[model samples]
Target: MNALLSKIFCAQRVLKNTPPQGEIPDDETLLRRTFRVAWPSTLESFLVALVGMVDTIMVSRLGAYAIAAVGLTTQPKFICLAVFMSLNIAVSALVARRKGEGDREGANRVLAQSMVLTVMFAIVITAIAILFAEPILRLTGSNAETHESAAAYFRIISAGMIFNVMSMVINAAQRGAGNTKIAMRTNLVSNGVNIVFNYLLIEGHFGFPRLGVAGAAVATVIGTMVALAMSVLSVAHPEGFLYLQFQKKRFRLERSTLATIANIGSSSLAEQLFLRFGFLTYAMIVARLGTTAFAAHQVGMNVITISFAFGDGLSVASVALVGQSLGEKRGDLARIYLSFCQRVGLFCSLTLAVVYSVVSRDVFRLFSSEEEILVYGEMIMRMVALIVIMQVAQVISSGCLRGAGDTKYVAIVSLVSVACIRPLAGYVFTYPLGMGLFGAWIGLVLDQFMRLILTSIRVRSGKWLNIRI
Candidate 1:
């Protein structure tokens, strides 16, 4: 017992000293810098998630059909915008590296090329969505009663895809430049606008047209347009850190820049596609259980996504710090930043897990008064509490790898765990074992654990440090 205690003491000491190998800043300095970048992003993501929850709560009053209608759109909408979102990841990483290298022209050029790409992709995706919204809804397993509302919402939102994509890319560029406050403010304003309009339009509170589900779609579009305008103005401002030159020469598509961004972005795109496909399948499986189950699942998802916002906020910081560190040829600093982010993510997740576990019943009650929905939703939230810490760890690690231009590995791992394992496990648990919604959540927890293990392995291997954007 004495020898064991001595070994435990030695391990504790080693763990305490084990940051990445390099001269890191003092803990206070590191924490300050991390929060300087992280808080704005965290606030923005939390506000976004809050808006989603509000949307769910508001629509829940409309009935289960309304909830399922909106929920059905989530994965499909993500699939539609996957390309633009992935491209923005590349834009963020490239802009960060250029900024670190003090190459303002290079960074601006990346922005310009990214804008051009965004416009083209947005136009194409919008056209496809507008043309195929119904068919896509049907393919995603929307039932007869829900698909009509889903299609209407999908069409209107798809029409405004350009606004959303542009807003995202511009904000991503600003984040890469370490100007997170702009994005935060934009999202905050947008959320406020969305909530106000959702109230006015959904139920026709203020003599507005009672558009129902279409009202929610319209509100989102308008909010996105407002955000797009804010982002554009910020970048166009002369005193802005990443102000665009808008010269004809600057607007020209540089093949090398395009190729480089595409190289990094393709992996991100694949990862999103894999994840979305898995979600699509999972949704389909749940849809088979009927409307109440799916609605309960959506409510559970909205609440769980709240935890993701915190992790994602830390992820934004990781991307900025790690990308900048690598650009300065300081792999050690990159690793140190990643370590700090992981610690922050783990703590935040633990807090969220405990809170959700304790108050989950109350939280689910906020979204629905239906006893059945509330019961299942609470169960799902409890399952979420069990897995959120692992989920956040994986998300932050993926961000670190992304900043280091190691997206392909992340994509591959996601494909294996989320895309492949999750749906398969979900089906087995939900149908073969007859565990219902509980089984589906078990599959989700397994996927999170798998991702946590895989991403932790990749980050610890330190191979990402050598990857060059």
Candidate 2:
């Protein structure tokens, strides 16, 4: 026990330690700067994640099939959004670098070029997703009873792809430019709209039609539309930091700009692909265990994702801070900021870990009262509580690397751990090992730790400091 406690303290010291090369801000200054950027992003992400959980809770009212049906569309939906998602990473990093360089025009150019590419890709992917929705869901382990409902949900979501991707790219640029509050405000209003509509549309309350599973999808799309409109208005003002020029000439894509975007986005795209592939495979493995298991898994996943939001929000701060510092030729400051971001993330993760563990069973009950589901979900939540610590650390680590244009390394890690390790491990544990859903979660735990170790090593090596965009 003494050895264990010592090791834990050692780890905490290492995470909190900052390099001496930079004139580090005092603790109060560091905390204020970190929270100034992080809180809005964190709140935005938490609200967005909360909306997903709320969606599950509302849909669960229609029965397990409805829950499973909605869950089935998740991976395929992310799969379709993969390209834009990767591009948005580049957008955020490049915009931050430009902001630090004091090249406002370059930042706006990055925003415009990203928007152009996103639209072109969104159209093609959206059409394909809608056309092949049924076959895709079936391939994802959807069955006779769930396939039709899942397909309908998938199609509605796909139909709104343009709006979602556009808003996402713009918001990414906003975050990179140190304008997190705009995105947070946008999501706050939009998610509020989503919840209100969910209440009215799901079971025909307040004279709204009963659309069932499709209603959830529709509510989500409506929220995205609102988000897109707000995102555009955000950049429409000519005086804003990331304004979008309406002139046709300003929209012209330059080769150098395109090359820069491709340089960062291509690798991040590979990472996104690997991430979605691994996650899709993992979700499919759990789905094969039947609706009750999948519903419980989905609920557990939704709950765990809330913890992820804290890390993700802090990661947004890390990316902007690291990229901007690097752009200003302050590698020491970059190092210091990332170290501070990781420490903040670690604190939040530990807090969430305790909360999830303490209320594990009660939390699952909010979604379902089935005895088997309650049993499976409780165990999963306990595992998730432990996973958040490593998961958040790795996520922030990856963000730091990506901001420094070390996306190739991050992508390689994703390919190895997420695409390769997770699915294989999950299958082996779930089948050969006979650990059931718990076994699959064991696979997830391994994946997060592997990522954390690799990313931590890279961050410590400090090689990412020299990478140029």
Candidate 3:
């Protein structure tokens, strides 16, 4: 059993810390506190993806064409999310710092500004997607048969961007406040509603006609609205640590605040853009290998996505913890927090890696009955698991750097690894050597390896310790 499990879940170790006299909490206390914040957010993220998985299951009944259509349409969804997540990156860091410094007013200002930007982006993105929906679908490599449904789905989902942005922005604030339960509770409510709506609308159940492609988009919209409502209510509740009150006079954007947010936000946005583009590039390559391979890739990638969602949660906690420690003028505390988070992430990622290498075939088989797809998917995913497990250090360390307001450098490093090196490696490996599918997957590993080195060096050098605001 041990050998069977070694393919994933290999990293295992407790977080360590040493409390100062009447100053820092003891190691056990610190770890527990961080875990309390991280666990729910992590679980929430995992569950968030589960809801999507369920949506996929429900939509699959429409047939394989529908499944493929949904899968293809989701690419643009990722791109849009990548764009908006940038602002959340800045919002989380800024709000965390403000809360740590006991500046609720400042945090509120940041939240308000984030909302404004999100609203503006929503208007622009939705208009663009709606006006040129067909072109966008074509750009994503969709065939004519799938184009109509994909375009329609994209159009409607674009309308929901406002609510999606609102929910994300609010959670960014709440997560940065070191209060994740609010976000988790809101997600639970929204996801529950989403499942019911998807079931009812997709199948035309309970007197509702089956809406097909449009139904999925409508379900997503309803979920976003519900999630937004929960977010607004949560923030408004007296006991909630984070809430937004419209400011009559605080509407103007401060240059310093804009500069900080833009600096961090743009950096984060750039990294995700590059990362997603890399994945999209790899997907294109896989698409050439055969439809079967591409479909298998899609199924296997979801597992990786599920795993990374937890990593995202852990990294977010690292940001909040490190930012708060810095706000308290405790650089040493921040460093300690950084180390502890790094250790925890490393352990969790490695553990999952072991699990994948061993039981990945069984896991992959759960999603597909076709032996060929399962076999290839198991092989490919095992490759991903190998790198992803050790790469948690890089993710958490990058989060630590961003938390300390070193966003620009982090962006630079990420661009080099993700943007330049990754695509270049993939191209060379694919075209010149004829390595094809395997080459593309291996290229991803190399990109992550380089990122691991860059992030580790940045964290160790302590230059991020000097950044303020």
Best by lDDT: 2
**Weakest 10 consecutive residues of candidate 1 by summed lDDT:** 5-14
lDDT of 2 by residue, 1-469 (tens): 6565344333235435554554656545655776788889988998899998998999999999999999999999999988998999999999999998999999999999888899999999999999999889998999987998999999999999899999999999999988999999999998999998898888989789999999988999999999999999999997899988788877788999999999999999999999999999999999999999999999988987899899899889998888998888888778767877887788789999999889989998999899999999789989998999998999999999988989999999999899988999999999999999999999999999899999999998989999888
- Reference-based lDDT, each prediction: 0.87, 0.90, 0.76
Kindly report which residue pairs in candidate 1 clash with one another. none
By lDDT, is 1 or 2 better?
Answer: 2
Candidate 3 lDDT over residue span 115-142, tens digit each: 8788888888878877887876777666
**Against the hidden reference, what TM-scores do the models get?**
0.95, 0.95, 0.90
Give me the runs in candidate 1 sitting further than 4 Å from their true place: 1-23
Candidate 1 accuracy as lDDT: 0.87
Candidate 3 lDDT score relative to the true structure = 0.76
The deviation in Å at residue 246 for candidate 1 is 2.2
Sorting all predicted structures by TM-score, with the top scorer first, yields 2, 1, 3
Which candidate do you rate higher for lDDT, 2 or 3?
Answer: 2
